[model samples]
Structure formats: structure tokens, C-alpha cells
Target: MPVTPQPLGRRERNKQEKLDRITAAATELFAQYGVDDVTTQQIADKADIGTGTLFLYARNKGELLLLVQNAHYAEALERGRAEAETIPNVLGAVMAIVRPIVECNRVQVDNGRFYLREMVFGDPAEPHHGQALSIVARTEEAIAAALGRHGPIATGDAATTARIISAVMFVTMAASVNASLTTAAILQDIEAQVSLLARR
Candidate 1:
């Protein structure tokens, strides 16, 4: 027989509720006004929590960026996975996996720039650092799965090739946000890179 999942206790439930509220509020405010322009007090007010309570969740704006984007990135990964399944080639498949996230970045490029930077360089001791790692791991898994479905890529494990594809997509996305390149131009560059890897 399958084991039943345990219900969350009151304290755990309350903590999760606060976390959810803060994530929702931050995602909205950051998407609308951009991360650099938003304040912790504004996020607290939006979440209906005291500044002190908000501090318990995120020590500062940088942590808040990771907290907010982690959920969005997870959602993007899921969407990318589904889209990747429908694509015929590994290049298209990988692009499918990255498109949602790249689009999210396109909306508020400044936040995307800072958020990506933080994810890349933030101290591992931070709570959201783990979340970012988990999310990225899932994305890489999605790319590998997509490549598997599309058929064999050139020699080497799909996971390793997927890592290269992910890096390319991320670089393209970062350039789109920070370097003022058009998404189309960045995607074209990504396509050029993918052709060599996927070798269609």
C-alpha cells in the first residue's frame, strides 16, 4: 500500500503561507515596477506582513530577488518542459525549454540581470541559493529529456550536452537583458550555436 503524505503542522503551514504571500507580492511588484525600484517595505506592505516578519523571510532585497524569482523560474521550467516535448529537433527542443524564462527576463531585464547575477555569484549560505540550484538542475533535466525524445545527439551524455545548451541559452538571455541586444538577435545567435551542437 502507498503511504499517505503527512499534513503540515500549524507553524509550518503559517510559515509556508507567509512565504507564498511574499513570493506572490514580490513577483508582481518586481514584474510591474522592476526589482531595482521596489523596496522591502513595499513588499512587506503588499504581503500584509510587518517589515520585521518580512526580514525573517528575506534579510534584504537581494535575497528577496531570489525568493521571488525562484517560484517564477520553477513555473517557467515546467512550461518549457511541456513545450520542448512538441519540438522535433534538439535545438528547437532546448530553445523550447529556455523560451519562457527568456521571455520573463525580457519583461523586466534589469531584475533579470540582477537576479541572474545573484544566482551565479550569491553565497551558497543563502536560502534561495539552494532553490536556484534545484530549479536549474530541473531545467537541465528537462533539456536532456527533450533531447532524448528528439533522438540521439552527437556522442556524450545528454546531460552534459544539455548543460552546454543551457549555458548558451542563458548567455543569450543575459545579453538580451544586460547588453541591450534584441531577443530575436539573441535567439538567432542561439540558433546558430544549436545547429553546431545538435548537428541537423
Candidate 2:
């Protein structure tokens, strides 16, 4: 008879199990009830863990929400960067970045909704806003680089134009999420928006 492989250590296995449970419960609850309506106790119950155990992983609801958003956003950004590399045209690059985010917003609508709530109501003095702003700045830089190479935009105004385009993209994304617009619709609208910006 083949010997059975030893199982994972209790502590390591239990910790992984708890994390999985917590994430699964959070995804389901936030999806169904909206993040604002879901409670830590509810999440804990859904995970079949005590509320206290839940706190061992997350300090509070806000932190848990931030964690969830960060995970999703990181994945989306990676995909955006990959798509950006493939597109040769500046407009194509910008659209690649925006399209992934819109898709993520649609797929993770609840988490997207929760992120919007935090952006509105969370401590305005918090550093998360600064971090998010930095991301926008980096995106603007990428657009500027892509556009500066071709006869895309005036060299002197490339940065400004990129920033303007970034602002338009974000506002459009927010509007799309608010209106529950599909990603395809968002991309279609973006083509018109970018065309107007190209003339600037």
C-alpha cells in the first residue's frame, strides 16, 4: 500500500481555510446585499466562523473592504498593463486601459459600488486617496508617452492632454457604473470622447 502523504500543519491549513471562507462569504454577501448593508457578523456567520475569528483577519469592515478592492484592482491593473503593451496607437493604449477597468467594474459591481462609497464617505484625510491619485498620475504618464511618440498630440501639451484624457476616462467610468452601463457601451462612448480630446 502507498503511504498517505502527511497533511498540512494545523495552523497553516486552518489559516488558509479561514481566509478562503472569509473571502467566499464576503463575495457572496457583498454581491447580494451590497457592502453597505452587510455586517461583519453576517460575514462571519456566512463563513461559519465566530465574529471574533473574523476580526483576527480584518480589523473592521472598512479594512476588509479595502483589502477586497485592492486585490481586484491589482489584478485589473496587471491586465490593463498587458493590454497597453499590445496596442501600438496611443488611442488604442488608452482604450485598452479603460476597457479593463470598465469590465472589472461590471464583473465586481458590488465591490465597485463599495469602493465608490468609500471614495465618497471614507475619511477624506486618509492616504488611500493620495495613493489612488498617484495611480491616475501614472496612467496619465503612460498615455503621454504613447501619444508623444506619434503625431498624436503637440509635444509641449502632451502631459496636459494626457491628464485631461485621464480625467475624462475616469468621469466616464464613474458615470457608466452609476448608470449600470455595459463595458461595451463604455468603450463605444470612449471612442467619441477620445476623438474630441484629440482635437484639443
The model with the greatest TM-score is 1
Overall lDDT per candidate, in order of appearance: 0.82, 0.71
Residue pairs with backbone overlap in model 2: none
TM-scores for the candidates = 0.85, 0.69
Q: In candidate 2, residue 71 scores what lDDT?
A: 56
Which tens-of-lDDT digit does each residue in 1-200 have in candidate 2?
Answer: 99999989999899999988998888788778777789999999999999999988776676567545655665676677677777877678767766776676667565675565565566645555444445556777766766676454776688888888777766666664455776687678876888677655
Error of 1 at 7 (Å): 4.2
Best by lDDT: 1
Model 2, runs deviating above 4 Å: 1-21, 48-62, 108-110, 124-137, 151-157, 176-178
lDDT of 1 by residue, 1-200 (tens): 99999999999999999999998999899889988899999999999999999999888888999987887888988998888888787778888877787776666778888888888888778889889878878988887787777776543577888888888877777664435876676667787887787763
Q: Model 1: which residue pairs collide?
A: none
Model 1 weakest lDDT span, ten residues long: 174-183
